[model samples]
Target: MREPLFLIGNVNVDLVMGPQEPWPQPGTEVIVPESEFRVGGAAGNTALALDVLGVDYRLIASRGDDMLGRWLAEPFGARAEAWTVAEGATTVSVGIGHPDGERTFFTTTGHLHSFKLSDVLSQLEEAGDGRVALLVGPFVIPALLADYDELIAILRRRGYRVALDTGWPDGGWTAQVRTRVAAWVGHCQHVLVNDIEARGMTGADTVEAAAAIIRPLMPDGASLVIKCGPDGALAWRGNEHVAVPAPKVDVVDTIGAGDTFSAGYFASLVESSDLARAVTNGVTVASLAVSTRPRRYR
Candidate 1:
Protein backbone atom coordinates (compact mmCIF):
# COMPACT_ATOMS: atom_id res chain seq x y z
CA MET A 1 0.00 0.00 0.00
CA ARG A 2 1.25 3.45 -0.90
CA GLU A 3 1.69 5.99 1.88
CA PRO A 4 -0.84 8.79 1.54
CA LEU A 5 0.58 12.14 0.45
CA PHE A 6 -0.84 15.45 1.70
CA LEU A 7 -0.10 18.70 -0.14
CA ILE A 8 -0.77 21.96 1.67
CA GLY A 9 -0.46 25.14 -0.42
CA ASN A 10 -1.86 27.31 -3.19
CA VAL A 11 -4.07 26.55 -6.21
CA ASN A 12 -4.02 28.58 -9.41
CA VAL A 13 -5.21 28.66 -13.01
CA ASP A 14 -2.31 28.93 -15.45
CA LEU A 15 -2.35 30.82 -18.72
CA VAL A 16 0.62 29.67 -20.83
CA MET A 17 1.70 31.48 -23.98
CA GLY A 18 4.22 29.79 -26.23
CA PRO A 19 7.02 30.71 -28.65
CA GLN A 20 7.19 34.45 -28.11
CA GLU A 21 10.34 35.89 -29.65
CA PRO A 22 12.73 37.65 -27.29
CA TRP A 23 9.90 38.09 -24.79
CA PRO A 24 7.80 41.24 -24.47
CA GLN A 25 8.80 44.53 -22.91
CA PRO A 26 6.37 46.56 -20.87
CA GLY A 27 3.68 48.20 -23.06
CA THR A 28 4.78 45.96 -25.96
CA GLU A 29 2.93 43.03 -27.47
CA VAL A 30 4.65 39.86 -28.62
CA ILE A 31 2.58 37.55 -30.72
CA VAL A 32 2.26 34.16 -29.10
CA PRO A 33 0.99 31.61 -31.57
CA GLU A 34 0.12 29.00 -28.97
CA SER A 35 -1.52 29.01 -25.59
CA GLU A 36 -2.80 26.48 -23.04
CA PHE A 37 -4.47 26.46 -19.64
CA ARG A 38 -3.66 23.96 -16.91
CA VAL A 39 -4.05 23.34 -13.22
CA GLY A 40 -1.09 24.88 -11.42
CA GLY A 41 0.31 26.40 -8.19
CA ALA A 42 3.20 25.02 -6.20
CA ALA A 43 1.01 22.72 -4.14
CA GLY A 44 -1.56 21.98 -6.80
CA ASN A 45 1.06 21.31 -9.46
CA THR A 46 2.79 18.76 -7.24
CA ALA A 47 -0.49 17.10 -6.37
CA LEU A 48 -1.57 17.09 -10.01
CA ALA A 49 1.76 15.61 -11.04
CA LEU A 50 1.36 12.95 -8.38
CA ASP A 51 -2.13 12.25 -9.66
CA VAL A 52 -0.91 11.92 -13.24
CA LEU A 53 1.78 9.53 -12.03
CA GLY A 54 -0.91 7.35 -10.35
CA VAL A 55 0.17 8.34 -6.87
CA ASP A 56 -2.40 8.77 -4.10
CA TYR A 57 -2.25 12.30 -2.70
CA ARG A 58 -4.76 14.83 -1.42
CA LEU A 59 -4.35 18.54 -2.12
CA ILE A 60 -5.49 20.95 0.59
CA ALA A 61 -5.70 24.56 -0.59
CA SER A 62 -7.91 27.62 -0.65
CA ARG A 63 -9.87 28.48 -3.74
CA GLY A 64 -12.13 31.42 -4.45
CA ASP A 65 -15.88 31.11 -4.14
CA ASP A 66 -16.02 32.17 -7.77
CA MET A 67 -16.02 30.92 -11.34
CA LEU A 68 -12.22 30.86 -11.53
CA GLY A 69 -12.24 28.45 -8.63
CA ARG A 70 -14.73 26.33 -10.54
CA TRP A 71 -12.37 26.36 -13.49
CA LEU A 72 -9.41 25.50 -11.30
CA ALA A 73 -11.23 22.41 -10.08
CA GLU A 74 -11.64 20.98 -13.56
CA PRO A 75 -8.15 19.51 -13.83
CA PHE A 76 -8.26 18.00 -10.37
CA GLY A 77 -10.71 15.28 -11.53
CA ALA A 78 -11.97 13.27 -8.57
CA ARG A 79 -9.97 15.36 -6.12
CA ALA A 80 -11.89 18.52 -7.01
CA GLU A 81 -14.07 18.32 -3.94
CA ALA A 82 -11.09 18.58 -1.63
CA TRP A 83 -10.59 22.30 -2.36
CA THR A 84 -11.62 24.74 0.35
CA VAL A 85 -13.34 27.78 -1.13
CA ALA A 86 -12.61 31.19 0.35
CA GLU A 87 -14.36 34.52 -0.23
CA GLY A 88 -12.21 35.91 -3.04
CA ALA A 89 -11.22 35.15 -6.62
CA THR A 90 -9.04 32.21 -7.47
CA THR A 91 -5.33 32.83 -8.19
CA VAL A 92 -4.03 33.11 -11.76
CA SER A 93 -0.61 33.04 -13.44
CA VAL A 94 0.32 34.30 -16.90
CA GLY A 95 3.36 32.37 -18.12
CA ILE A 96 5.30 33.18 -21.28
CA GLY A 97 7.81 30.88 -22.91
CA HIS A 98 10.55 31.18 -25.50
CA PRO A 99 11.02 28.97 -28.57
CA ASP A 100 13.37 26.85 -26.49
CA GLY A 101 10.55 26.28 -23.99
CA GLU A 102 12.02 28.37 -21.21
CA ARG A 103 9.27 30.16 -19.29
CA THR A 104 8.85 33.29 -17.17
CA PHE A 105 5.78 33.69 -14.99
CA PHE A 106 3.67 36.47 -13.49
CA THR A 107 1.03 35.61 -10.96
CA THR A 108 -1.71 36.73 -8.58
CA THR A 109 -1.87 34.37 -5.60
CA GLY A 110 -5.49 35.37 -4.78
CA HIS A 111 -7.41 33.43 -2.17
CA LEU A 112 -4.48 31.14 -1.50
CA HIS A 113 -3.47 33.59 1.19
CA SER A 114 -6.59 32.77 3.14
CA PHE A 115 -5.68 29.28 4.26
CA LYS A 116 -5.84 28.76 8.03
CA LEU A 117 -4.81 26.09 10.47
CA SER A 118 -8.38 24.85 10.80
CA ASP A 119 -8.43 23.98 7.12
CA VAL A 120 -5.13 22.14 7.32
CA LEU A 121 -6.10 20.17 10.39
CA SER A 122 -9.43 19.20 8.87
CA GLN A 123 -7.68 18.01 5.75
CA LEU A 124 -5.25 15.94 7.81
CA GLU A 125 -8.14 14.26 9.52
CA GLU A 126 -9.21 12.90 6.18
CA ALA A 127 -5.87 11.12 5.73
CA GLY A 128 -6.86 8.73 8.58
CA ASP A 129 -4.17 6.29 9.75
CA GLY A 130 -2.22 6.18 6.51
CA ARG A 131 1.42 7.24 6.70
CA VAL A 132 1.06 10.87 5.69
CA ALA A 133 3.65 12.87 3.83
CA LEU A 134 3.18 16.65 4.08
CA LEU A 135 4.57 18.85 1.31
CA VAL A 136 4.81 22.63 1.70
CA GLY A 137 6.22 25.02 -0.85
CA PRO A 138 7.39 28.65 -1.15
CA PHE A 139 4.14 30.34 -2.07
CA VAL A 140 2.46 29.72 1.22
CA ILE A 141 1.06 32.89 2.90
CA PRO A 142 3.29 34.84 5.26
CA ALA A 143 0.84 34.72 8.12
CA LEU A 144 0.71 30.97 7.80
CA LEU A 145 4.31 30.84 8.87
CA ALA A 146 3.15 31.86 12.31
CA ASP A 147 1.50 28.49 12.57
CA TYR A 148 4.58 26.61 11.46
CA ASP A 149 5.54 25.18 14.81
CA GLU A 150 2.01 24.03 15.58
CA LEU A 151 1.59 22.58 12.15
CA ILE A 152 4.81 20.61 12.36
CA ALA A 153 3.97 19.42 15.82
CA ILE A 154 0.59 18.14 14.72
CA LEU A 155 1.93 16.32 11.70
CA ARG A 156 4.74 14.79 13.72
CA ARG A 157 2.32 13.61 16.37
CA ARG A 158 0.21 12.05 13.68
CA GLY A 159 3.22 10.19 12.26
CA TYR A 160 3.60 12.29 9.14
CA ARG A 161 6.99 12.92 7.63
CA VAL A 162 7.14 16.39 6.11
CA ALA A 163 8.93 17.67 2.99
CA LEU A 164 9.48 21.34 2.19
CA ASP A 165 10.18 22.87 -1.23
CA THR A 166 12.16 26.10 -1.03
CA GLY A 167 10.55 28.70 -3.27
CA TRP A 168 11.38 32.38 -3.82
CA PRO A 169 11.34 34.16 -0.49
CA ASP A 170 8.59 36.76 -0.49
CA GLY A 171 9.72 40.25 0.39
CA GLY A 172 6.64 40.57 2.53
CA TRP A 173 8.24 38.17 4.99
CA THR A 174 10.78 40.91 5.75
CA ALA A 175 13.53 39.73 8.09
CA GLN A 176 11.56 36.94 9.70
CA VAL A 177 11.32 34.63 6.69
CA ARG A 178 14.71 33.01 7.04
CA THR A 179 14.20 32.25 10.69
CA ARG A 180 10.77 30.74 10.05
CA VAL A 181 12.08 28.73 7.12
CA ALA A 182 14.98 27.43 9.19
CA ALA A 183 12.56 26.29 11.84
CA TRP A 184 10.66 24.32 9.23
CA VAL A 185 13.84 22.76 7.83
CA GLY A 186 14.74 21.56 11.27
CA HIS A 187 11.38 19.89 11.63
CA CYS A 188 10.73 18.46 8.18
CA GLN A 189 12.15 15.11 7.12
CA HIS A 190 13.37 16.39 3.72
CA VAL A 191 14.07 19.68 2.00
CA LEU A 192 13.83 20.14 -1.80
CA VAL A 193 15.29 23.22 -3.42
CA ASN A 194 16.44 24.40 -6.82
CA ASP A 195 19.93 25.86 -7.27
CA ILE A 196 18.79 29.47 -6.87
CA GLU A 197 16.71 28.88 -3.78
CA ALA A 198 19.37 26.67 -2.24
CA ARG A 199 21.98 29.38 -2.66
CA GLY A 200 19.77 31.93 -0.99
CA MET A 201 18.95 29.63 1.89
CA THR A 202 22.43 28.26 2.52
CA GLY A 203 24.65 31.13 1.30
CA ALA A 204 26.48 28.63 -0.90
CA ASP A 205 27.85 29.38 -4.37
CA THR A 206 26.98 26.02 -5.94
CA VAL A 207 24.38 23.28 -5.64
CA GLU A 208 26.79 20.90 -3.90
CA ALA A 209 27.94 23.62 -1.55
CA ALA A 210 24.35 24.58 -0.80
CA ALA A 211 23.54 20.93 -0.08
CA ALA A 212 26.45 20.73 2.32
CA ILE A 213 25.37 23.86 4.17
CA ILE A 214 21.72 22.82 4.27
CA ARG A 215 22.64 19.34 5.55
CA PRO A 216 23.90 20.61 8.89
CA LEU A 217 20.78 22.73 9.45
CA MET A 218 18.32 19.88 9.10
CA PRO A 219 17.82 17.26 11.83
CA ASP A 220 20.71 14.77 11.98
CA GLY A 221 18.93 12.21 9.76
CA ALA A 222 17.08 14.56 7.44
CA SER A 223 17.81 14.71 3.67
CA LEU A 224 18.58 17.67 1.43
CA VAL A 225 17.96 17.60 -2.34
CA ILE A 226 19.32 20.27 -4.66
CA LYS A 227 17.92 20.48 -8.18
CA CYS A 228 20.33 21.64 -10.92
CA GLY A 229 18.03 21.95 -13.96
CA PRO A 230 19.60 20.16 -16.98
CA ASP A 231 22.54 19.29 -14.76
CA GLY A 232 20.32 16.89 -12.75
CA ALA A 233 20.04 16.68 -8.94
CA LEU A 234 22.26 15.98 -5.93
CA ALA A 235 21.01 14.52 -2.66
CA TRP A 236 22.52 13.98 0.78
CA ARG A 237 21.42 11.66 3.56
CA GLY A 238 23.76 12.13 6.52
CA ASN A 239 27.35 11.88 5.23
CA GLU A 240 26.41 10.02 2.02
CA HIS A 241 25.93 12.13 -1.10
CA VAL A 242 24.61 10.97 -4.50
CA ALA A 243 24.36 12.70 -7.85
CA VAL A 244 21.43 11.62 -10.02
CA PRO A 245 21.57 12.44 -13.73
CA ALA A 246 18.70 13.82 -15.76
CA PRO A 247 17.91 12.02 -18.99
CA LYS A 248 18.88 13.88 -22.15
CA VAL A 249 16.08 15.32 -24.18
CA ASP A 250 15.34 18.24 -26.53
CA VAL A 251 14.57 21.39 -24.58
CA VAL A 252 10.97 22.42 -24.11
CA ASP A 253 9.04 24.46 -21.57
CA THR A 254 10.72 23.97 -18.19
CA ILE A 255 7.63 25.16 -16.37
CA GLY A 256 6.55 22.73 -13.68
CA ALA A 257 9.66 20.65 -14.26
CA GLY A 258 10.98 20.99 -10.72
CA ASP A 259 7.59 20.36 -9.22
CA THR A 260 7.23 17.31 -11.47
CA PHE A 261 10.56 16.00 -10.22
CA SER A 262 9.43 16.51 -6.63
CA ALA A 263 6.24 14.60 -7.21
CA GLY A 264 8.20 11.77 -8.75
CA TYR A 265 10.73 11.79 -5.93
CA PHE A 266 8.14 11.59 -3.18
CA ALA A 267 5.99 9.21 -5.17
CA SER A 268 8.93 6.90 -5.59
CA LEU A 269 9.41 7.00 -1.84
CA VAL A 270 5.76 6.14 -1.25
CA GLU A 271 6.13 3.29 -3.70
CA SER A 272 9.52 2.10 -2.51
CA SER A 273 11.54 3.45 0.40
CA ASP A 274 14.81 3.37 -1.58
CA LEU A 275 16.48 6.81 -1.58
CA ALA A 276 18.60 6.25 -4.69
CA ARG A 277 15.58 5.02 -6.65
CA ALA A 278 13.58 8.00 -5.44
CA VAL A 279 16.23 10.41 -6.72
CA THR A 280 16.31 8.51 -10.03
CA ASN A 281 12.55 8.79 -10.40
CA GLY A 282 12.73 12.54 -9.72
CA VAL A 283 15.31 12.98 -12.48
CA THR A 284 13.21 10.92 -14.88
CA VAL A 285 10.08 13.03 -14.46
CA ALA A 286 11.96 16.34 -14.55
CA SER A 287 13.70 15.26 -17.75
CA LEU A 288 10.35 14.38 -19.28
CA ALA A 289 8.93 17.77 -18.26
CA VAL A 290 11.74 19.72 -19.92
CA SER A 291 11.70 17.62 -23.09
CA THR A 292 8.03 18.16 -23.91
CA ARG A 293 6.53 21.32 -25.40
CA PRO A 294 3.64 21.60 -22.95
CA ARG A 295 4.91 19.07 -20.44
CA ARG A 296 3.81 15.41 -20.28
CA TYR A 297 3.39 12.99 -17.41
CA ARG A 298 4.71 9.47 -17.01
Candidate 2:
Protein backbone atom coordinates (compact mmCIF):
# COMPACT_ATOMS: atom_id res chain seq x y z
CA MET A 1 0.00 0.00 0.00
CA ARG A 2 1.13 3.55 -0.58
CA GLU A 3 2.18 5.46 2.53
CA PRO A 4 -0.38 7.95 3.77
CA LEU A 5 0.85 11.37 2.67
CA PHE A 6 -0.78 14.75 3.24
CA LEU A 7 0.33 18.31 2.55
CA ILE A 8 0.00 21.44 4.68
CA GLY A 9 0.63 24.88 3.16
CA ASN A 10 -0.52 27.51 0.64
CA VAL A 11 -2.28 26.70 -2.63
CA ASN A 12 -2.17 30.20 -4.07
CA VAL A 13 -2.51 31.50 -7.61
CA ASP A 14 0.48 31.94 -9.88
CA LEU A 15 0.92 34.14 -12.94
CA VAL A 16 3.94 33.26 -15.04
CA MET A 17 5.41 35.22 -17.95
CA GLY A 18 8.55 36.24 -19.78
CA PRO A 19 12.07 35.11 -20.74
CA GLN A 20 12.55 38.67 -21.92
CA GLU A 21 16.16 39.66 -22.55
CA PRO A 22 16.14 43.12 -21.00
CA TRP A 23 15.08 44.55 -17.67
CA PRO A 24 12.65 47.27 -18.65
CA GLN A 25 12.77 50.68 -17.00
CA PRO A 26 10.04 51.61 -14.53
CA GLY A 27 6.78 52.98 -16.04
CA THR A 28 7.44 51.01 -19.27
CA GLU A 29 5.25 48.01 -19.99
CA VAL A 30 7.23 45.18 -21.52
CA ILE A 31 5.43 42.40 -23.28
CA VAL A 32 7.01 38.97 -22.87
CA PRO A 33 7.00 35.99 -25.20
CA GLU A 34 4.92 33.65 -23.01
CA SER A 35 2.65 33.51 -19.99
CA GLU A 36 0.40 31.21 -17.95
CA PHE A 37 -2.01 31.38 -15.04
CA ARG A 38 -2.01 28.43 -12.68
CA VAL A 39 -2.09 27.18 -9.09
CA GLY A 40 1.24 27.35 -7.28
CA GLY A 41 2.98 27.37 -3.88
CA ALA A 42 5.49 24.88 -2.57
CA ALA A 43 2.66 22.63 -1.41
CA GLY A 44 0.47 23.44 -4.38
CA ASN A 45 3.17 22.52 -6.86
CA THR A 46 3.87 19.31 -4.97
CA ALA A 47 0.14 18.58 -4.88
CA LEU A 48 -0.20 19.10 -8.64
CA ALA A 49 2.81 16.94 -9.38
CA LEU A 50 1.72 14.28 -6.91
CA ASP A 51 -1.70 14.12 -8.52
CA VAL A 52 -0.11 13.67 -11.93
CA LEU A 53 2.10 10.94 -10.53
CA GLY A 54 -0.99 9.14 -9.18
CA VAL A 55 -0.20 9.51 -5.51
CA ASP A 56 -2.97 9.60 -2.91
CA TYR A 57 -2.89 12.55 -0.49
CA ARG A 58 -4.77 15.33 1.31
CA LEU A 59 -4.00 19.06 1.18
CA ILE A 60 -4.63 21.04 4.37
CA ALA A 61 -4.78 24.59 3.10
CA SER A 62 -7.02 27.63 2.72
CA ARG A 63 -8.20 29.61 -0.26
CA GLY A 64 -9.04 33.28 -0.15
CA ASP A 65 -12.71 34.07 -0.77
CA ASP A 66 -12.11 35.61 -4.17
CA MET A 67 -12.09 35.01 -7.90
CA LEU A 68 -8.46 34.01 -7.92
CA GLY A 69 -9.12 31.41 -5.26
CA ARG A 70 -12.01 30.02 -7.28
CA TRP A 71 -9.82 29.96 -10.36
CA LEU A 72 -6.90 28.24 -8.67
CA ALA A 73 -9.13 25.62 -7.08
CA GLU A 74 -10.52 24.53 -10.43
CA PRO A 75 -7.44 22.52 -11.32
CA PHE A 76 -7.62 20.72 -7.98
CA GLY A 77 -11.26 19.75 -8.55
CA ALA A 78 -12.89 17.66 -5.79
CA ARG A 79 -9.65 17.50 -3.90
CA ALA A 80 -10.10 21.20 -3.08
CA GLU A 81 -13.69 20.92 -1.94
CA ALA A 82 -12.83 20.70 1.77
CA TRP A 83 -10.20 23.43 1.95
CA THR A 84 -10.80 26.32 4.36
CA VAL A 85 -11.67 29.76 3.02
CA ALA A 86 -9.74 32.74 4.32
CA GLU A 87 -11.48 36.13 4.52
CA GLY A 88 -9.53 38.07 1.91
CA ALA A 89 -7.87 37.98 -1.49
CA THR A 90 -6.02 34.82 -2.40
CA THR A 91 -2.23 35.02 -2.47
CA VAL A 92 -0.75 35.48 -5.95
CA SER A 93 2.76 35.12 -7.29
CA VAL A 94 4.00 36.74 -10.48
CA GLY A 95 6.90 34.79 -11.94
CA ILE A 96 9.05 36.34 -14.64
CA GLY A 97 11.00 33.60 -16.33
CA HIS A 98 14.46 34.32 -17.63
CA PRO A 99 17.00 32.52 -19.80
CA ASP A 100 18.03 28.99 -18.71
CA GLY A 101 14.85 28.68 -16.69
CA GLU A 102 15.74 31.27 -14.05
CA ARG A 103 12.91 33.31 -12.54
CA THR A 104 12.15 36.31 -10.32
CA PHE A 105 8.92 36.48 -8.35
CA PHE A 106 6.73 39.17 -6.89
CA THR A 107 4.27 37.65 -4.43
CA THR A 108 1.44 38.91 -2.23
CA THR A 109 0.79 37.61 1.30
CA GLY A 110 -2.98 37.42 1.07
CA HIS A 111 -4.67 34.49 2.83
CA LEU A 112 -1.44 32.66 3.63
CA HIS A 113 -0.59 35.04 6.45
CA SER A 114 -3.73 33.96 8.27
CA PHE A 115 -3.55 30.19 7.86
CA LYS A 116 -3.25 28.49 11.23
CA LEU A 117 -2.90 25.15 13.02
CA SER A 118 -6.60 25.04 13.72
CA ASP A 119 -7.21 24.88 9.99
CA VAL A 120 -4.80 21.97 9.72
CA LEU A 121 -6.32 19.99 12.60
CA SER A 122 -9.81 20.40 11.21
CA GLN A 123 -8.95 18.62 7.97
CA LEU A 124 -7.38 15.50 9.41
CA GLU A 125 -8.64 12.93 11.86
CA GLU A 126 -6.47 10.73 14.04
CA ALA A 127 -4.21 8.82 11.67
CA GLY A 128 -2.18 5.67 12.24
CA ASP A 129 1.53 5.78 12.77
CA GLY A 130 3.68 6.23 9.63
CA ARG A 131 1.55 8.87 7.94
CA VAL A 132 3.66 11.65 6.48
CA ALA A 133 2.60 15.27 6.60
CA LEU A 134 4.60 17.50 4.32
CA LEU A 135 4.56 21.09 5.59
CA VAL A 136 5.85 23.64 3.12
CA GLY A 137 6.62 27.36 3.31
CA PRO A 138 6.00 27.69 7.06
CA PHE A 139 7.87 30.99 7.16
CA VAL A 140 5.23 32.60 4.95
CA ILE A 141 2.33 31.59 7.16
CA PRO A 142 2.42 33.99 10.10
CA ALA A 143 -0.06 32.17 12.27
CA LEU A 144 1.43 28.78 11.58
CA LEU A 145 4.99 30.00 12.15
CA ALA A 146 4.04 31.44 15.50
CA ASP A 147 2.55 28.14 16.64
CA TYR A 148 4.96 25.76 14.94
CA ASP A 149 5.76 23.75 18.07
CA GLU A 150 2.12 23.38 18.92
CA LEU A 151 1.45 22.36 15.35
CA ILE A 152 4.11 19.70 15.57
CA ALA A 153 2.72 18.46 18.85
CA ILE A 154 -0.76 18.29 17.38
CA LEU A 155 0.42 16.34 14.33
CA ARG A 156 2.37 13.97 16.52
CA ARG A 157 -0.66 13.41 18.69
CA ARG A 158 -2.61 12.41 15.59
CA GLY A 159 0.21 10.05 14.60
CA TYR A 160 1.83 11.83 11.64
CA ARG A 161 5.48 12.24 10.81
CA VAL A 162 6.26 15.76 9.68
CA ALA A 163 8.32 16.52 6.61
CA LEU A 164 9.29 20.18 6.65
CA ASP A 165 10.05 22.08 3.47
CA THR A 166 10.26 25.64 4.71
CA GLY A 167 10.65 27.76 1.61
CA TRP A 168 12.70 30.99 1.60
CA PRO A 169 11.79 33.31 4.43
CA ASP A 170 10.28 36.67 3.49
CA GLY A 171 12.49 38.51 5.99
CA GLY A 172 15.63 36.81 4.73
CA TRP A 173 17.44 34.03 6.66
CA THR A 174 18.84 35.79 9.68
CA ALA A 175 20.64 34.04 12.55
CA GLN A 176 17.46 33.78 14.57
CA VAL A 177 15.56 32.23 11.68
CA ARG A 178 18.36 29.76 11.14
CA THR A 179 18.27 28.77 14.82
CA ARG A 180 14.53 28.16 14.67
CA VAL A 181 14.89 26.24 11.43
CA ALA A 182 17.43 23.98 13.05
CA ALA A 183 14.98 23.29 15.84
CA TRP A 184 12.34 22.42 13.28
CA VAL A 185 14.79 20.14 11.51
CA GLY A 186 15.48 18.28 14.73
CA HIS A 187 11.79 17.76 15.25
CA CYS A 188 10.74 16.56 11.81
CA GLN A 189 10.97 13.03 10.45
CA HIS A 190 11.98 14.34 7.03
CA VAL A 191 13.45 17.57 5.71
CA LEU A 192 13.51 18.71 2.07
CA VAL A 193 15.50 21.72 0.93
CA ASN A 194 17.44 22.85 -2.07
CA ASP A 195 21.19 23.50 -2.16
CA ILE A 196 20.84 27.22 -1.51
CA GLU A 197 18.39 26.77 1.35
CA ALA A 198 20.52 24.08 2.91
CA ARG A 199 23.64 26.21 2.73
CA GLY A 200 21.85 29.23 4.05
CA MET A 201 20.24 27.36 6.94
CA THR A 202 23.40 25.61 8.10
CA GLY A 203 26.00 28.29 7.32
CA ALA A 204 27.88 25.70 5.36
CA ASP A 205 29.77 26.51 2.18
CA THR A 206 28.97 23.37 0.19
CA VAL A 207 25.91 21.16 -0.26
CA GLU A 208 27.81 18.20 1.20
CA ALA A 209 28.96 20.29 4.10
CA ALA A 210 25.46 21.52 4.67
CA ALA A 211 24.10 17.99 4.59
CA ALA A 212 26.70 16.94 7.11
CA ILE A 213 25.63 19.69 9.46
CA ILE A 214 21.92 18.95 9.03
CA ARG A 215 22.19 15.19 9.32
CA PRO A 216 23.32 15.26 12.95
CA LEU A 217 20.52 17.63 13.92
CA MET A 218 17.75 15.36 12.64
CA PRO A 219 15.98 12.97 15.00
CA ASP A 220 16.95 9.33 14.74
CA GLY A 221 16.21 7.84 11.31
CA ALA A 222 14.96 11.11 9.81
CA SER A 223 15.69 11.79 6.16
CA LEU A 224 17.51 14.89 4.93
CA VAL A 225 17.21 15.75 1.25
CA ILE A 226 19.28 18.44 -0.42
CA LYS A 227 18.09 19.16 -3.93
CA CYS A 228 20.96 20.23 -6.21
CA GLY A 229 19.36 21.46 -9.42
CA PRO A 230 20.86 20.12 -12.73
CA ASP A 231 23.68 18.37 -10.85
CA GLY A 232 21.12 16.19 -9.04
CA ALA A 233 20.12 15.47 -5.39
CA LEU A 234 21.52 14.09 -2.16
CA ALA A 235 19.94 12.37 0.82
CA TRP A 236 21.43 11.54 4.20
CA ARG A 237 19.91 9.54 7.02
CA GLY A 238 22.08 8.56 9.91
CA ASN A 239 25.20 7.01 8.34
CA GLU A 240 23.61 6.32 4.99
CA HIS A 241 24.20 8.90 2.25
CA VAL A 242 22.93 8.62 -1.30
CA ALA A 243 23.56 10.73 -4.41
CA VAL A 244 21.68 10.78 -7.71
CA PRO A 245 22.41 12.56 -11.00
CA ALA A 246 19.88 14.28 -13.24
CA PRO A 247 19.58 13.92 -16.99
CA LYS A 248 20.19 16.91 -19.24
CA VAL A 249 17.06 18.49 -20.67
CA ASP A 250 16.15 21.68 -22.52
CA VAL A 251 15.41 24.64 -20.24
CA VAL A 252 11.83 25.75 -19.83
CA ASP A 253 9.88 27.04 -16.78
CA THR A 254 11.93 26.64 -13.62
CA ILE A 255 9.24 27.89 -11.30
CA GLY A 256 8.19 25.25 -8.76
CA ALA A 257 11.02 22.93 -9.76
CA GLY A 258 12.11 22.30 -6.19
CA ASP A 259 8.55 21.66 -5.09
CA THR A 260 8.19 19.31 -8.04
CA PHE A 261 11.28 17.51 -6.81
CA SER A 262 9.68 17.16 -3.40
CA ALA A 263 6.67 15.45 -4.93
CA GLY A 264 8.81 13.14 -7.01
CA TYR A 265 11.02 12.23 -4.11
CA PHE A 266 8.29 11.48 -1.62
CA ALA A 267 6.12 9.73 -4.19
CA SER A 268 8.92 7.28 -4.81
CA LEU A 269 9.95 7.11 -1.18
CA VAL A 270 6.46 6.12 -0.13
CA GLU A 271 6.31 3.41 -2.75
CA SER A 272 9.59 1.63 -1.97
CA SER A 273 11.38 3.46 0.87
CA ASP A 274 14.60 3.25 -1.11
CA LEU A 275 16.61 6.41 -0.63
CA ALA A 276 18.58 5.95 -3.88
CA ARG A 277 15.49 5.32 -5.99
CA ALA A 278 13.66 8.22 -4.36
CA VAL A 279 16.48 10.64 -5.09
CA THR A 280 16.79 9.37 -8.64
CA ASN A 281 13.06 9.69 -9.24
CA GLY A 282 13.08 13.20 -7.81
CA VAL A 283 15.91 14.33 -10.09
CA THR A 284 14.37 12.66 -13.12
CA VAL A 285 10.92 14.09 -12.52
CA ALA A 286 12.26 17.56 -11.82
CA SER A 287 14.44 17.43 -14.95
CA LEU A 288 11.38 16.65 -17.03
CA ALA A 289 9.33 19.31 -15.21
CA VAL A 290 11.88 22.04 -16.04
CA SER A 291 12.03 20.97 -19.68
CA THR A 292 8.28 20.76 -20.32
CA ARG A 293 6.10 23.75 -21.06
CA PRO A 294 2.73 22.74 -19.65
CA ARG A 295 4.49 20.75 -16.90
CA ARG A 296 4.13 16.97 -16.96
CA TYR A 297 5.10 15.33 -13.64
CA ARG A 298 5.14 11.69 -14.70
Q: Of the candidates shown, which would achieve the greatest TM-score relative to the real structure?
A: 2
Q: Quick one: how many clashes does candidate 2 have? A: 0
**Residue ranges of candidate 2 with Cα displaced over 4 Å:** none
lDDT of 2: 0.86
lDDT of 2 by residue, 1-298 (tens): 2766889887888999898767789899998888998989888999999998989988888899999988878888887888889999999999888776688889898999888888887887677377888889888789988998788878877778889988888787899999988888877989999999999988889998898888889899889998888889888877788988888888788888999998898889777988888888999889999899778877
Measured with C-alpha atoms, the lDDT of residue 260 in candidate 1 is 86
TM match of model 2 to true structure:
0.96
Q: Find the 10 residues in a row with the least total lDDT in model 1.
A: 126-135
Instruction: Provide the global lDDT of candidate 1 against the true structure.
Output: 0.76
TM-score of each: 0.90, 0.96
Question: In order, what lDDT does every prediction score?
Answer: 0.76, 0.86
Count clashes in each candidate, considering only residues at least 3 apart in sequence or on different chains.
0, 0
- Which residue pairs in candidate 2 have backbone atoms (N, alpha carbon, C) closer than 3 angstroms, thus clashing? none
